[model samples]
Target: MASNTGNAFDFNLFKRLLKYTNPYKGTFYFVGVAAVLLSFFSVLRPYLLQVTIDDAIMPSDNEGLVFYVALMLGVLLLEVISQFLFIYYANWLGQEVVRDLRVNLFEHMLKFKMKYFDKSAVGRLVTRAVSDIETISSIFSQGLFMIISDLLKMLVVLGFMFYKSWQLTLLVLTVLPFIIYATRVFQKKMKVAFEDVRNQVADLNTFVQERITGMKIVQLFTREKAEYEKFKGINDKHRKAWVKTVWYNSIFFPIAEMSTSITIGLIVWFGGLRAIENDSLSLGVIIMFIELSQMLFRPLRQIADKFNTLQMGMVAANRVFGILDTRSFISDEGSREVGKLNGKIEFKDVHFSYVDDEEVLKGVSFKANPGETVAIVGATGAGKSTVINLLNRFYEIDSGQILVDDIDIKDVKLKSLRSQIAVVLQNVFLFADTIMSNITLDHPDITEEDVITAAKQIGIHEFINTLPNGYHYNVKERGVMLSSGQRQLISFLRAYVSNPSILVLDEATSSVDSYSEQLIQDATDKITEGRTSIVIAHRLATIKKADKIIVMDAGRIVEIGNHEQLLQQKDGYYKKLYEVQFMAEESLRS
Candidate 1:
C-alpha cells in the first residue's frame, strides 16, 4: 500500500491482531447476530415509509397510518438497543485485546539479550510499547465496528432499494466508480505517508532521549548552541513527515466527501425528475434512499482512516518483530552439567573480534590455579578486559575452549557457571529505589542484617550510617545521588553479598578518589583472600601485591611474572609502563 514505492502493507500483522478477538467469541457472535437484526429492521423502515406515503397518507386513512407509525417506532427502539449492545461489546473486546498485546510485547522484550539493546534505541521501544498498541486498539474499536455496521447497512439498504425500484438503485450506484477511483489513489499515498511519519517520529524521539540524557555533559562543555542546531535538523525531518501525512489526510477526506455528496446529488437530480414526469416514486422512498446513501458512504470514508492507522501499526510491528526474531548471540543449551568448579581456569587458543573487520583478542592463552590471584594490565583495548569477558562467557569465542576445573566451559549451564562467579562491573548499575531494596534487588527474603553484613565487608557501613535515613535512603535513578566512588562501593557490596567462588573485577577502583580508592583496595584485598580473582587494572602501582601479573599487548600475553621480575625486563613494554606510572607517583609525592 505504498504507492509508487511499491511496498505492500504487511497483511500478516492484521492476521496476528485478529487472534486476540478469538478469545472474545461471545462478543463476536453477538456483533454478528445484532448486525443481522439491525439490518433486518432497517429494511422495515423503508417499507413502512412507502406504505405510509403511497397508501395511508394518499387515501387519508388515519387508523392504518397510526398502526404503521407504531411499527416504525418499535423498529427504531430495537435498532437503538442493538446499536448500544454492538458498541459496548466492540469496545470491551478492543481494550482487552490491547491489554494482552502490550503484556506479550513487554514479556518477549525481557527475553531478548543485551545485544538487542545495543542495536535499538530506548525511545523506539517505548513507542512500540505505547503508541503502536494504541493504533491497533483504535482499529478494533473504530475500524472493525464501522466496517461491520456500514457493510450491514449497505446490504439492507441496497436490497430494499432494488426491490422497490432497480432504476433508482442503479442511478444511485453509477457514481461509485468515481469514489473508488479517488479513494484508491489516496489510500496508497496515505498509507505510505503515515508509515514514513511514524518512523520519522520514532527517530525524533530517539534523538531527544539521547540529547536529554547527555544534556548535562553538553552544558559542561558549553555546546548548547551546536546541540540545538543538530536537534533542529531532526525536527525538520519529522516535520516533513507530518506535513505529508496531514496533506494526504486533508486531500483524501475532502475528495471522499465530495464523491459521496455527488452520489446523493445524482439521486436527487434523477429521483425528482422521475417523480415529476411519471408520478411513480414517493417522497418517503426518496428520503429512505438519501439516509441509506449517507450510511454507505460514511463507512467507506472511515475505512480510509483505518487504512492509514493500519500502516502505522504495521510499521511498528515490523520493527518489533525484527527484534523478536533476533537470536541471542550468546546462549547455552543449558542441558550439560559440569557440577561444581575448583576455580582452576585455562584459556586455550582464544580468538575474538567484536567487529569482524579487526581482531581484539587473538590466540590468547593463560591458566590460573585455585585460590590464586591473577592481575591483568594493558593499555585500553589490549584484550585485557576481553579475557574476563571470556571467563564469564559473555561472548562465545570464534575458536577456543575455556576450562574450569579441567571441565570444558561450553558444557556447563549458564546459570550454574554464572552463580559461581561474582562480577563487579566497571560501570555499576543501580535501580531507582531505596538503598536496602537496590542492594537486595527485591529478593523478598533478604534481611536488613544481610545488607549490613555485605556493606560492612565493603567498608561502606559507616558511610550509610552517616546518612540521615541510613540504609533506607533513596539511591535515586542509577544511584545518581551518590558519588561515583560511593556507587562503586555499593556495587562491590552487592557482588560480595553473592559470596561466589570466583571474583572478576574490571578496573574497579579506576574512578575512586585517592582516599576512597585505598578503602576499596583494602576491601578488595580482604574479599580476594582464599579465592580466585582475575582483575583488570589500569594503575599498575595498585597490582604490586598481586600474586602474578599478566602483561598483555594487542591480543596476546607478552609477559607473566611477579612485579619485580617483570620490572627487570627493561627492554619490555611492562617495564616501560611501570616507569611512566612510577614517575607520576614520584611527582605527586614531591
Candidate 2:
C-alpha cells in the first residue's frame, strides 16, 4: 500500500535501476552509441536541406544539386539504420533487465518468513512481479534512451541554429522557459496519477484473484450478486485511476502543442522581417531555421511524455525495492550440516505469537524421541499447527529452544534442517502437472522409477494406475482432478520418496471417505515404521496407537501420555476433547 510521493526525477532510483543493466552492458552501450549516431544523422538532414537550397538550387548548379541530393539521401539511410539499432537494442536491454528483476524478486519472496506471506496478498505480489516490472521495461525501450537521443538531436540542432544566426535562435528559444514550467507541472501530476494507477491495479488484481479462487464458495453460498458488486467497485476504482492519467495527458499535450506553434510563429515572423530588411539573411537560412526550430522544440515536447514514462518506472522501482529491502528473512546462521538427523525433536519452554502481544503458544514444551510417533490433539485454536510451524522454523518462536539430535535447530543450516523433514498437510496441495511430476516435484534426483517405487511402498500405486494415464495423469491445480483421499495418498507417496528422517502429518486424514481413510492409515503405518513422525489429528481413534499423545487447550499443554493412559484419567483434557471433537467419528466407526 506504499505510494511513491517523491520528486519527479529520482536520480537515486534511476541509478539503482541502471545497475540491473550490468549483465547486458554490451547491449546497453550499443543502444547508447546508436542514440548518438541517430542524433547525428537526424541533424544532418536539416543541414543538407539548407545546402541544397542555398548553394545548389539557388545558384542553378545542376552538378552541385545532384551531389547534395545524393548526400541527403545517404543521410536519411544512415538515420534509418541508426533508428533501427536504437529501437532494437533498447528493447533488448529492457527485456533482459526485467527478466533478471522478475527472477530476483521471486527468489527474494521465496526466502521471506511465513509471517510475511501471512500478511501479504498473492495478487499484490503477482502485480509487482509481472505488471509493475513490465512497466519498467518501457523506461528503457521508450523513455531513457529515447530521451537521450532527443536531447542530443536538440543540442545538435541548437548549435546549427546559433552558427547560422544567434539572434533568431535566441528569439525562438524565448518560449522555452514557459514550456519547461508546464512540463514540470505535468511530470509532478503524472507521477501522482501513475502511483495511484499502480495501487489500484494491485487492488483489482488481488480482488479478482481472491474472488476467482473462491468462486465455488461464492456459488455455494449464493453470494454471486454481492461478490459481483464488490468486483465492480474495485473495477471502477481501477478505471478511475487510469482516467486520471489520461486526463493529465489530455491537458498537458495540448499546452505543449500550443507552445510549439507559438515558437514556430515567432521564427517565421522574425526571420522573414530580418531577411527582408537585410540580404545577409538568405531564404535558405530562414527555411533552415524553421526546420531546426521544430527539431529543437519537438524533442522538448516528446520529452514531456517520455519523462512520464521515466517517472512511472521510478515509482515501480520504489515499490519493488521496498520488497527487496525487507528484513523479514528467517536468519540462517546455523552452520551445522544435517545430512542425516537422528529425528529427536524437543521443544523446551517455547512461546510464540503471530501478532505482537496475542500469544498463540504459551510456554508449551514436548519431546518426540527418534522413531517415535507423537500425536497432538486439541480444539481448533489450541495451537496444534503453531507447533508444526515452529518445528520447521517457518515462524521463529518468541522464546524457546528447539533441538534436533541435541543440537538447537537454530544452529543448523536451514536447507540441511528442512531437507531431513517432510510434511503432509490436511489440505494437500498438488501442482498442475502429471502425477509423476507432482510426486517428484521436479526434483533432479527423483526419477519416475523412484516415484513409482515410493507410490507402491505407500500402497497408492494401484490406485494411480487405475487412472486414465496412470502416473502420467495430470492432477490439475491443487490436485482438483483427484479426490481428497487420492490427493492425500499422493502426498504420502511424495513424502515417502524423500526418505526424510522425520515426517509431520497435520490432520492428513480429516475429511476423506472411509475407504480412502483406510488406505491412508495403511500408508501411514508403512511410512512411519522407522522414522520420527508427528501426527496432528481430530480423530482420537486414528491415533489411539501413537507412542505418546499431547493434549492442548487455549495455547497450553493440558495433558501428556499414551492414548490409554490419558483416556483412563477421568476428566482429563484429552478425554474431554475426545468426547467433544471425536465422538462422531467414533460413532461412525461403530
Candidate 3:
C-alpha cells in the first residue's frame, strides 16, 4: 500500500509532471494561448448583450441593434473556435506525454533485478503501468488545463461585474467565501476518498490477476467457493471506496448549485430595488450580473471537481516515480566485451540467498570444462535451481566468484554474458503470438528460415507442419492452445535458434510424455554438442551419459562422479537419491 499525505495539490509533483511536456512544448504553449483567447472571447458574449440592450434596443436605433447583434454572433463564433483549439490540443499533449511516460516506465522496470520482482506483484505493476498512467493523462486533460481555462473565465467575469457596478458586484460575491470554504472542506474529504479508491483499485487488480492465473489450482483443490468469497470481499471493498467519492460528490454539487442560486436571488432583489430607485440603472446590467455570477461560481465548483483529478494524478505520479527511483538494479559496471572463447564455467566458493540470513547455496563449488555436460541432481529445495540462477546472474551472489571462460561473470557486460547462454526451464512460458514469432522472439536477425532450419534439426519441424497454420499458428496466452509437451518442444526450438555457447536444462523434460521426452533427448544431444551444458533433472536414466554427476543435499554437494562411479558407492547420497527418485520412472519406462 502506498501512503497518501492528504495534500490535495502538491506543487512539486505538478512541476515534475510538467517536465514530461518538454517533448511536446509547442502543443502545450498553443493550448495556453488558446486558453487566454478563450477567456477573452467568452467574456465578450455577456458584454455584447449588455451593449445591445443598453445602446441599441432601448434607444430604438435599428442600425445600432443590427451592428450589435452581428458583433455578438462574431464573439460567439470566436469563443467556439478558441474552445475547440483548447480541447483538441490539450488532450493531444496529454496523450503524447503519457505515451512517452509509459514507455520509459516499462523500460525502467526491465532493468530491475530478479529480487525486486520476487517481492512485487505483477498485478500492481500492471496497474501502475496501465491504469495509473491513464489517470495521469486525465490530470492534464480534465484537471490542470481545464482548471486554468475555468479560472481565467472566472477572473474575466469578475472584472466585468466590478466595472459595471461595484455595489451590486460586491453583493453578488458575498456567497463566494461560503462557497470557497465549502470547497476546501470538500477537497480534503475527497482527497482521502480518492486515495482510498486508488488503493482499492490496485488491490482489486492484484486479486483478480492472481486468482485468474491460478484458477486451475483453485478448481483442482475444490476451493472455488472459498476463492469466490475472497474475491467478493475485495470487490466489496472496491465498491465501498468508490461510493465514498459518490457521497462526497452528491453532497458538494448541490451546495454549489444552491450557492449559485442564492447569488442570483440576491442580485435580483438588490439590483431590482436599485434600478427602481435610480432611473439610469438599466435592465441589461441586472441580466448581465446574473450571467456573470453563474460564470464565476460555476468554475469554482468545477475546480473542486478538477482538483480531484489532479490529486489522483499526483497520487499516481508518486507511485510511478517510486518505481523509477528504486536503486535495486544488479550493478552492471563490468566493461569486458564478450567474444568467442572455450565454453568453460566455474563456481568458486559460491554463497547465495534469496532472503537475508537464509542461505540457499552454501560455499558450493564446481567446474564444467568446454564441451562438458554436468548433470546436477537433487531433491526439491536442495538448491538445484539456485545454481542455474547464479550461473545466469539473475541474482547476485552474496560472496563468491562465478567465472565463465576464465573471466569472472560479474566482470562481463550483462547483455553479452546472457547472450552466450540459453536456459529452458521446466515451466516454459510462450507469449501470445504466432509460433514463428515465439520461436524467434521477434528477433529480426533470426528469420523464419532460421527457425525452420533449427526446428528441422531438432525433429519438431514435422509436428509443427501438421498444425493449421504451421509456423504462423497462434499460440494463445501462455501457449494454452498447445499441450504441455508441445509447448516444451516449441521452447526447445527457441533455444536451438539462439545457438548459445552454454545451455541449461532445468528439469526440462520432467513433465512431458514419453514421445516428447525422446524428442527432447535427441534435441538435447544436438544442442549440447560442442557447448558446456548443465542438466538439472530428476530422471537418473536421462543423464547417465553425462561427463560428471553432481548430487546435492541441503545446499551442499554431497557426491560428485559419473553415473557408474557414483552407483559403485552403495551408501552414497547419489545412490540413495537415484533409488528413491528414479525407481518409479524406471519402472514406467520399462
Candidate 4:
C-alpha cells in the first residue's frame, strides 16, 4: 500500500524526506561542495593531457611536460580527498537522519491506540523500523549524492569534449537519444520490480517472525511439515520478486555497455578521418575524446544502477512515513492531573465496539464506590474483558462516560489516570530479565526492597526465594523459565509493588495448580484490602466475598448483587452459572 501511493522518484516525497536533513545540513552542504569539486577535477585531468600531448610532447619541451604532469598529479590528489570527504560525510549525514527518524517513528508508535496494534502485524512493523530505514540511508550514501556527483562529472566531461572538437562531440551526441530512451524504460520497469521486491520482503519477514513466535503451537500439533511447505511457498514468492529485478538489470546493463562501446568507436573513426584528411586533428585531441567519452557515458550507465537504489529507498520511505502518518492515538486533551485518586469509578451507559456495527458493550453501566471490591463474572465473549479495557481507556467507548472520582476520564491526562491503577492480566508477560527487574520494571520509585516487601505481603516471597537465585533469577523471555502459576505470582507482585489505588485482576488464578491457587487467593485477599478492586473471573468461588457482583450475558448486565442476594433469584444467569461451577468442583473432589 505504501509503494502504491507514490511515483518511483516522487519529487514531493523527496522534498518531504529532505526535511530530515535540516538537522545535518552542515554535512549535506559539505557533500554538495565535494560534488562540484569532484566534477571540476574530473574534467581537468583530460584537458591537461590534451595540452601536454599537443604542446609539451610535440614540441619536445621536457620542462613543460614535467610541470603539466605535476599539475595533473596534484589534481588527482585533490580529487581523491574530495571523494573521501564525499563518501564519508554523505554516509554520516544519512545515518544521522535515519537515527532521528527511527527514534521519532518509535516514539510516535508508542502513543498509538491499542486498536492500531491489534490490526497490524508485528513483523511488518519491525521491517519498517529496521531494514526499511537502513535502505533509506543508502539514498544518501550511494544513491542521491553519488548520482549528483556522477551527473555533474558527466556534464563537465561533455563540456571538455566540445571544447576540444565539436565534430567528435556531435558524433557522441548521436548515440545519446537511444541510450537515454533505453535508460528511461529500464528505470520504469525497475521501479515496479523493486516495489514488488519490497512487498515480498515484508511478507517473508512477517511469515518467519510469526512462525518462530508460534513454534510451540506448530510442534505441539505436529504441524511442522505443513508449516514448512507453507514457508516454501512464501519463500518462492520472495525469490520470484527478486528475480524480476535481476532480470531487468541483466537486460539493461548489457545494452548500456554496448552503447558505450559504439559511441567510442564512432568518435575515434571521425577524429582519425579528420586527422588524415587536413591535419586539423591531433593525436592528443583524439585520445582526449576517448577518455572524455568514458567520463561522459559511464556516468549515464551508472546512473541507471544508482537510480534503482534511489527507487528502492523511496519505496521504503513511503512505508515508514505511512506509519508516521497514522492518527490512531487516544486524544489526551485533558490537562487535569488527579493526584492519587480515591478510587471511585463509574461507567454511565457505556456503549462500545472493537469493530463497526458490532457492539461489544451495550449500554453497560456500573459503579464501584471508594474502597469497594466489585466482581464481574460471565462466560467468554460476554464483554467482561471489554469493561476492564474501557476502564483503562485502551479502547474508546462509542457513546459513554467513564468517570473516576466524578471526573470524566476523558478530561484526565492519560499518564496521570493510568498511573493510579494497576492490572494483572490473564496471560501474564514478563521481560527477559531478573525477577526483581520484571517486578519493578525499572520504575525509579519502586526499588528492589519495595518489590521484596510487596512479594512477602502477597505470600510469593518464599516461592521467589526457592528459585535458583532468589529475586535475582532470570525469567528468560516471557517468563518461559517459570511455570504458569509462577508467572502469575510475579505479575501479582508487579501490581502490588505499583501501590495503585485501583487494582484489576482478570482471571488471575484461573490456570494454576491447587496449591498455587491457594497462594494466589491468599495474595489476592491481601492486596485487595482497602483498595477499589475489580475482579473478573469465571470461577464463581473467587468473588463470593466481593461487596458487589455484576453478572453479564451477551453484552448486558443480567444481574447485580452480592453472592447471597444473587442466589436468591433461582432462574437468574448468575444462579445457573454458580450451580454448574459448584457441581463441577464437587465432581472433581469426589
Q: What is the TM-score of each candidate against the true structure?
A: 0.90, 0.97, 0.97, 0.97
Pairs of residues clashing in candidate 3: none
lDDT string, candidate 2, 108-158, tens digits = 999999999999999999999989999999999999999999999988888
Best by lDDT: 4
Local accuracy of candidate 1 as per-residue lDDT tens digits, 1-590: 11233354556666766777888888878877876777677677767787787778878989889988998898899989988887777778778887888898888786565546767899888887887777767666666665666677777778777887898788878876777677677777876776777788788888888888778899999999998998899899889998997888888789888877888888788889888999788777777778767766776787677666656656655655555555765667757665446789898888887666578888888888898888998887789877877788877788888988887878888778887888877888888888888777776667889889878876789988877699888988889988888887777777777777888887555567987777677678777788888888654445787788898999888999878899898698888887787567657757
Off by over 4 Å in 4: 1-6, 58-64, 508-510, 586-590
lDDT of 2 at 255: 87
Q: Which scores higher on lDDT, 1 or 4? A: 4
- Model 4, residue 314: distance off in Å is 0.5
What's the ranking of the predictions by lDDT, best on top? 4, 2, 3, 1
List candidate 3 segments past 4 Å from native: 1-3, 508-510
What's the CA error at residue 32 for candidate 1, in Å?
4.9
Report the alpha-carbon TM-score of model 2 versus the true structure. 0.97
User: What is candidate 3's CA lDDT for residue 223?
Assistant: 91
What is each predicted model's overall lDDT from 0 to 1? Answer: 0.77, 0.88, 0.88, 0.90
